[model samples]
Target chain A: MYFFQKNKYKIMLVASTAVLVVCIIVGSAINRRKAGGASDALGTVFTPLQSGVTGASDSVSGFFNYLTNMKGYEKENEKLREKIASLEDELRKTDNLKSENERLRKMLDLKENEKDYKTVAADVVAFEMDNFSKSYTINKGIKDGITQSCAVITPYGLVGYVSEVGRNWAKVCPIVDSKVSVSASIMRVGNTAIVQGDIGLMEDGLCKMTYVSKETGLEVGDSIETSGSGGVIPAGIYIGKVTEIKNDVTGVSQEAVIKPGVDFSDVNEVMVIKDN
Target chain B: MNYVLSYLTLAVLFVLQTTLGRYIDICGIAPDIIFVYVLCYSMYNYPVRAAVLSIIAGIIVDLYSSTHVGLNALLYMYIGLAVSNFASTLMKKNVWTVALGVVVLSILYHTVVLITQYVIAGHSGFVYPFVRIALPTAVYDGVVSLVLSLWAQWLSMDKIRGL
Candidate 1:
């Protein structure tokens, strides 16, 4: 009893340290299985708070952006008006082509090549605070039919996949994260390749497409799209355009750096593809 | 009362770090205000209290940002203990000393995180993160700590009696 009283602080320190080590082991196990109860509870509590803070931050940033770009908005508005008129004209032509294509498909008895996917749009509430991984949290979760490994995308292109889901929030690991790998194909060459996040290229907002055959000619401007071989992400989703090509460390395969169509840093809203 | 104020301040800093921190990032690197606050608090408090608070802060960070739970908790506990020990030996605490503590610990923290990442995840290429992230973040955190410590000194002399 005397010893316990004398070394209470030291005992507490040691006990806490041991508990943390055990927590690490248990946390890793739980993470491998899926989001655990502790993570879910944290997510439930923090999601609303994070959403409110993020909304406030966005408003503040938006106001600052408006102030800084006030002079350019007038010219931008004018340019956008002209672009809208041209796009309207193009839309009419596109509508006609779509109907003609539909008739041709029916006449040819061709099955649908593309599957219409059910999607849930969610607002990005917060981003991972560290630099190690490229991830963000969305306001939608399992309640919204979002599950682990669900493909996340924006209008521009593929964003990433759902890594962890909470009650009211989910963490999205972007395509640029080192842990993400997508089965991709060059749109121009039709050659399949593996698009993976590289630690070296992550800071530059780029991913690497590897496993390219030497015979396949890859150009700097070649577009890449998901091939959907994994069954997790749907096929024909635009990923990015190739910006650079380099020999792999093994010197046997070539790798191409890809700049994704979605601006990951600026992503505010995303669509989680639920099912097809 | 002091402990309550400290925890409240830490909570506010946590909120800001997750939200406003992204907007003010310099070259995709933001100051870890949570780390700075924890370090500062450790330097002025009991080692046991510092360690406990650091664990709480680390767990909060892990819950929000990390896939695993205790990596940061372990790191922060050690840092808090180390900083407490170092501070006890010091004759005085000031902006420069606090900034120095932040810079040194920031570098140590990143290095440990990188090594842990490499060990667990097989993530190679340490030189890039060290050069691009660790070095710049250390310097940036140092500057932020300097500014914040100075502000704290200006705000209430008794709050940071040593400073």
Candidate 2:
């Protein structure tokens, strides 16, 4: 008690700093491991807080959206009605195609593809808003069968994978973060390369595709997809389009700058590809 | 009583930092609201209390961050300690002190992060992140801290009056 009263703050500061540094150093060594106790404890406490805040913000923003769009409510209603009509028509066609696809799969006895994979849909409750970090927290977790290395994707393309899974929240390391790498291939030429985040290109929501042979015919708009080499991420998930090709710093290989298909800055909901 | 209020304020700010802060992102660089909060808090609080609060704030941030868990924690802890120590010596009341603290600390934070990335994680060289991310962000954060410091001062007037 005497010591506590005398140097309590100093003791707390040193102890906490030491603990945090250890978490950083040891946590880095065990990269890809699930979030430790601290994250889980905090996530458990804050997930509900985040969800509630997100819900409130969304509603508040939605109200402002309604207010702003009040001037065009009639036109927007008409457009929405037309869009719904067209969407219903498309939905019917899609239903027919889906049935046909199911029949064909049964007839051919083909292996299950991405469609057969189990997935968990999660809402982004919070973003890592800092200069040094690039991640977002999703309101899903072990209870939802979300595991580490599960591929996260938007409807348009790859978002990233689950890095740290908590009980009710998980941190997603998007492809723009420097630590993530996606095995990618050129859809036009089938030349395989590795798409990884680069510090320079990440600010623009771009990644670098390295290890492409110089002989591979690279085009400005060639589509890139996950090659599924590592087997963590399923094959044939659309990544992005190549925007530029440059000689890597090493000069041994050429690197293609890829523009991600998904607008990462605005991603709100993502599907986690979980192995059933 | 003040400590409770301060922590509650931080909790609310933490939520806002994660949610609403995304909207203010410019060119993929978001304002570090918690960093600003830490700086403001540290400038006025005892070093030990500031360190504890900063650590808590950093942990909350690291919980949502994609980077290694402890990096922000350690960074914020030291930042709190330094800012508080410096605030004791210098004129903590001035706008210049707050602005300079923000700019210097912003640079220091990013530089340390980049170093950790390159040295520890074997990531890319410093030149790219320095020019592309750090410099712009530091400037942005400096401006943001200046504005936030003024607001913080205004908010604390009631406590100052009570004192």
Best by DockQ: 1
Off by over 4 Å in 1: B118-120, B147-163
- What TM-score do all the candidates reach, one by one? 0.94, 0.84
Looking at candidate 2, what is the lDDT of residue B80? 89
- Candidate 2 docks at the CAPRI level of medium
Q: TM-score of candidate 2 restricted to chain B? A: 0.84
lDDT of 2 by residue, A1-276 (tens): 998989977787778867887988787787545777876887888888988888788888889989998979989899999999999999999999999999999999987764677888999998877654568889999999999989999899999888889889988988887778888889999989999887777777788889988889888899999988988898888999999988878887798889999887778899999882
Residue A119 in candidate 2, Cα distance off native in Å = 1.4
Q: Which whole-number lDDT from 0 to 100 does residue A68 have in model 1?
A: 99
lDDT of 2 by residue, B60-124 (tens): 77666635777787888899898878776665466667877787888888788778765468666
Runs of candidate 2 exceeding 4 Å displacement = A1-32, A63-115, B66-69, B118-120, B150-163
Q: Give the root-mean-square deviation of each candidate in angstroms.
A: 2.1, 4.2
